[model samples]
Target: MRIGLLSFAHVHAEHYQALLRSMPGVELVGFWDDSVHAQSYAERYALKQYLTPQLLLAQALDAVIVCSETSRHREVVELSARAGVHVLCEKPIACTLEDAEAMRDVCAQHGVTFMTAFPMRFDPSCGELRQAVHSGQLGSILGVNGVNHSENPSVHRSWFANPALSGGGAVMDHVVHLTDLLRWCFACEVAEVYAALQWTDGAGENGTALDTAGIVLLTLTNGVQASIDCSWSRPATYPRWGHLKLDVIGTDSLMVIDAFADHLTVYPPDLTRPVQWLGFGVDPNQAMLTAFLDAVQRRQPPPVSWQDGYEATRVVLAAYTSAQQGRPVRLRPARCESTEDPGDGQGS
Candidate 1:
């Protein structure tokens, strides 16, 4: 299948490009990006460059991965949908609920599949735990506590700290991953949200004000309580970009997930930068892409539907609202419109 990349602004775009090129039976037709760095990246990767997204769409591509900044997702997805191209959008679907709805509506109207790029769902550890929960191994779930802590993203991309560009700070970047995980494992929606936010280490603002650390507490529809630490408080010297862990409390047994637990840690002889951790596990991104490709090729709906993306975004937005209001915010149960094979919502 022929596939095009919509943007190269997100750091993951480079990795996704490599995956697309390496995957069998898939063609990375080309990519489009208006950023000044686009030419250098395209040249270094020997990639075809499209001056405008329209030209890339004119290639009659089968699907496009939209990895633009958080705020640019709606525009790119709408364009791809209009061109009859399925979309696999990066998470935190949009900066706002309204934008997320618009993207969902447009894709549905155009009759193209829309999948959220939520790689955690494909993580072997997360998938196995979710399966155990669904198969009644966990008996009755009591509560879930998850941590999605990461190094300050501004160290790599300054846009991540800008609210206008990224929606919020660490909360915006990390909340959706765990929220989607909880929803997938429990098969329920967030019924209410409460959050507490803070800015520490003198990490100042980026264009718009942003919180550097936060914790969100949520109550799911099935009476299960969940808490997420969506903080960017990891030190710069940390080995990996970030790590996710979910602790599931249940009546029968407790299950824990270390999403990137397959890693070897090393202490270097050099004192200056001594610690290094190497990951040696199946690439969850590859698994997610494969699922999306299968859906596109088989003319079946994607595993992660637009409604799933919208609901995840909604929960995150509500967290922000609760933080700002200094109180709990109630969320109405979301209505799912598609009968897609959810398959545990690996992509989001």
Candidate 2:
């Protein structure tokens, strides 16, 4: 399979590039990025750097990973879809619901697959949790508590703090991942959203405050209550670059899974990073890419569909609306791959 990257702007693009190159039978065709760092990436990776996305698409590529800034996703996805290439777009889908809808619609119109970059669905711990819930081991879920925190992304990319470029701040960056996972694991969609956000200093002007921290409360279609504590509150001196944990409360039992729990941590940290955490395991990103590639090779739709991306974006957008309006934002149930909505979802 021939695949190239559309942009190297996202921090994860380098990892994806390396994974693509190292994976067997997969050709990492190179990348396209107009940023000044493009040349350095080409030199570092020893891969061709296409001057324009069109030139990259002209190489008869099967697909491209769209890792551009949050706001640029629409234009790039459109370009790739028009060129008849499948897309694996970075999360939060887009800055606005309209843009996310447009991207999904265009890909559908062009008959190309649109897979959301939601690797959490492939995480080993998350998968086990899903099984426990589905197999009746968790027995009647009551509520959920999820936390996804990371060091301020502005340190990695300045665009992350610029609302015009990366959308809302920490909330936009982290909300969709947990949202997608919750919807996937519970076999439902967000029926309503109520959020409270803490803004960055001096950024509250014109209602454009960049969210530094937030707690988003969601009521799912099946009436399971879930709360996500999403923030960029981790300091540079922290032991890890990120954190993702989920606790599922059930009538008969409780389940907890931390994505970083199984890793080995070195005390005398490496000089390059704040801490050294190592593991011999399959990363979620690699698994997600493999799933996407398998579908592409088989000429089948991707496992993670466009509607997955759309509804995730919807939840994020709804969270912002709830925060701005100072009340819960009720979401109309989406017509996606969701399970049959249990009428008036009775739960603990």
Candidate 3:
């Protein structure tokens, strides 16, 4: 299948490019990015660089991965949908709930498959934790604590710290991962959000006023309380880019997941780079990409649907609202169902 990458602004875009090139039956049909960086990438990969999004979409591509900046997702996805191309969009679907809904609605109207790029759902450890909870091995879940901590991406990509481009600071970039995982584990939607945002640093890249750190408290429809430590607290000298982990408290037993724990830590003598983490385990991004390709080939819905992405973004956005107002924000209540799963395969 031929798949073109929409933009190269996202850090994961380069990783996806390498993986796609190595995968069988998948052709990396070049890319289109307005930034001058695209020229270097195109030259390095020896792939055609489309001068415009429309030109790339006109290549009869089966699918496109929208890796544009957080705020530009809608425009790129809409372009692809108009061309009848399936989409695997990067996380946080859009900056606002309205844009997210529109993206979901437009894709549905066009009858094209759309998926959110949430690679953590494909992590084996995370899958086991979800299974344990579903099978009653952990009894009834009472609470969950998840952390998605990372170094400031702005240090490497100027857009990450730009409020206009990234939507928010660390909270916007990290909250979706844990929020989606919690929804997947419990098969329920959040009912309320209470968050506190803070920034030890005066200002981030581009003088963005977005918080550098935050804590979001969520109440699930099923009465489970969850909290996420979404922060850009790591320094450049940190060993790895970041890590994801979660602790689940249940009536019977507790479950903890170190999603990126399958790695060997090395302390390099060189002062230039202090440490490194070499991983030999499964690459969740590769797994997610494979699932997307399989779904496209079989004409089935992708594992992580647009609704899942929208709902996750809603929870995070609500947290921001709660923080700004100094009160909990309540979401529209939904009738609780007894279904064992959320039905989206990747959850809603």
Candidate 4:
């Protein structure tokens, strides 16, 4: 499979770049990045850097990973679809519902595969948890509590806090993962959302304070209530980058999963930043890429579809709305069936 990366803006681009290079029978056809980091990436990867997306897409590529800024997702997806190339877009699909829907629609109209970048779906632990929940080992799921917290992403990429670029802050960045997981495991969509937000001391590009922390309460269509606690509260001195954990409560039993549990804590000689965590385990990103490649090779739809991303985005937006209105906000019926997994495996 011949594939190229649309941009190097997202942090995950580095992992995907390396994974693509290591995969058998796959060609990582360089990348197109509009940032200053593009030159360094071109040098490190030993791949030619295209000056613009048009120059890169003209390479007769089979697929592309859209890792551009959240707001530019629609533009890149539209371009790739028109060029007859399949897409694997980064999460929070877009800054708004209109843009996200447009990306999905364009891919469908062009008859190209469109997959959402939700790597957690491929995490072995998450997979096991999903199996246990779906199998009845959990009897009847009562409720769930999920936490996905991280250091301020803006510290790494300033765009993360910019509402124009990222749509919102912590809620926009972290809410989708758990929302998608809830939908994936429970086979339902969020029916209502009630949320509270905490903002950062500083403002973004336009004096608009971004939510640095959020607590979202969700009611699923299948009669399940779930709570997600997401924040950019981790300090830089922490041993690990962040965490993803979920506690599933069922009538028969409770299942808890800590995705980054397999790791070692190292105390470095440098006192400035003496301690850090070294995660040691299978790379979920690699598994996700493999699944994507397998689907493309066999002409099968990807396991994570555009609808999954779209639905997850809806939940995040509803949380913001709920917070602003100071009341629970009800969402529209999901396009996916309530009894089935949210992702229909239809790449298009």
Candidate 5:
């Protein structure tokens, strides 16, 4: 499959380039980016760079990866769909629900595949947790808790702080991963959200509207209560700012995934490692890109569909709305069943 890159503004673009190059059945036709810096970066990677979307689309590629700024996602998707090209868009899909829905509709109308880049779902450890939960190793799930914290970006990449550009700070940028994970793990939708937001000294100094600290309480459709603690300011020396810890309480046992420790610890009155470490030792970007290529070649749906992307965006958007209104925000009921295994199947 011939693939074209829509933009290179996102920090994750390098991951995509490396993965696309390594995939067996795919070719990196070329790339397009509006910013001169982005174009220069693409060139440094030896990618054929173009100045406009029209030129990129003219290559007649089979798929396009939209890794542009969040605000430009809808436009990129629309262009790709209109050109009869499949799309793999970066999250949080678009800046608003309307734009996300619009992209979905257009893709459907054009008969083009639409997938969201939610690589966490493909984690090997995540796969094991899903199986453990599904096989009744853990009984009915009770609650979930996640933490994603990182050092604030320097002023040089201040777009993350701008609401107009990045959507709405840390919640917009970080919460979707956990939200989507929870949906897949429990096979349920978020029913409501209550949240509190704060901006730290760094956020103020950066002159961006993004928050540095926040917490969100969620009520899932299956009666699982989940909470997310997300922050953007951490000591620079911290090993990982994006540390994630998940505790899934079931009637029979508890499953914990310590992403920072790179291990999945299971507790059944006696904590013991499972027969398999769910955390596969593979690069997530490579696994996800390979999956995308497989889907395209087989003419099958992507593991993380456009609908999945849209639902996750809705959940995150609801959290932002809840924080802004100082009241609980109710989510629309989910239209489809959630996947049990959020695995990007690469053995470590």
Candidate 6:
């Protein structure tokens, strides 16, 4: 299948480009990005670089992988859908629920498959925990706790800090990953959220709008309570780029996921870190992209639906709202409204 990249502004764009080129069924037709750095990276990687979206769509590619800024996701997805190209857009669909809904509606109207890039769902550790919950090994899930921490305060791109460009803050950027995980594991929706956020005025060379240090309390629709502690204040000397840990407790047993350790440890009075390790050695981005392509090829829905993306976005947006208000915020049900049609304009 012919594949094209909508934008290279996202850090993961290079990985996607490499994955597309390496995957057996995909051909990297070209890439389009407004950023000079993104264009330079595309040229260095030897991929065709397009100067405009019109040029990229003209390629008549089977799908477009969007790794643009979080705020620009709606525009890219809408444009791709209008061009009759399936889309695999990176997470945090848009800065607002309204835009996210618009993107979904456009894709549906155009009959183009839409998938959000959430690779954590495909992680081996996550997979095992999901299976444990589904198999009744964990009984009825009662509570969940998660932590996503990183020391890298420096963002190569400036948008990472601007609320207008990248959304609220680190919470908006990183919390979506955990929200998506919780949704997939429990099949539950976040009914309400209470949070506390902190920011540092001391500027690190990285111009970050806020250093993500916060705590979030979540009440799920199924009466399960969950908490997420997200921070970017870890000492720079820390070995890992980031840490993702989840503890899911049920009536009878509990499952702990340590993605950093690449293992799932279950506790049944005694903590039993599984003796056998399941390695998610495959490139998550590649795997997700391939799944999107397969859905397009088979005329089936994408693995992660647009509604899933909207739901996840709702959770993150709620956390931001709650944190800012210093009180709990109840989330409304997800909804989409159609917009006036924009005719497809094609060139890559």
Among all windows of 10 consecutive residues in model 1, the one with the lowest summed lDDT is 200-209
Residue range 73-191, candidate 6, lDDT tens digits: 98888889999998888878898988987887888788888877887776667878877977889888888999988764345565666667677666876788888888777776889
What digit string (tens of lDDT, one per residue) describes model 5 on residues 171-258?
Answer: 8877888888888877778899998998554464346445777898999888889999987766654444446668888889988886
Query: What TM-scores do the predictions have?
Result: 0.94, 0.92, 0.94, 0.94, 0.87, 0.86
Candidate 5 or 1, higher TM-score: 1
lDDT of each: 0.87, 0.85, 0.86, 0.86, 0.77, 0.76
In candidate 1, how many Å is residue 270 off?
A: 5.8
Scored against the true structure, residue 127 in model 1 reaches a CA lDDT of 86
Report lDDT (Cα) of residue 216, candidate 2.
Answer: 99
lDDT of 2 by residue, 1-348 (tens): 999899988989998998898899999998999998889999999999999999999999999999999899999999999999999999878988789878878887888878888887888888898889889998889999999999987777778888888878888899999998898888888999999999877543344557989999999999899999999988878776788999999988899988887678777645765566665586888888988887778776676777777788889889888999999999986766422122111110
RMSD of 2: 4.6
Worst 10 residues of 2 by lDDT: 339-348
On a 0 to 1 TM-score scale, where does candidate 3 land against the true structure?
0.94
Instruction: List the pairs of residues colliding in candidate 5.
Output: 122-344, 124-278, 125-278, 125-279, 149-241, 281-348
Where model 3 places Cα greater than 4 Å from the true spot, the runs are 200-202, 267-271, 334-348
| Model 6 spans > 4 angstroms off | 202-211, 235-237, 263-280, 335-348
Better of 3 and 5 by TM-score: 3
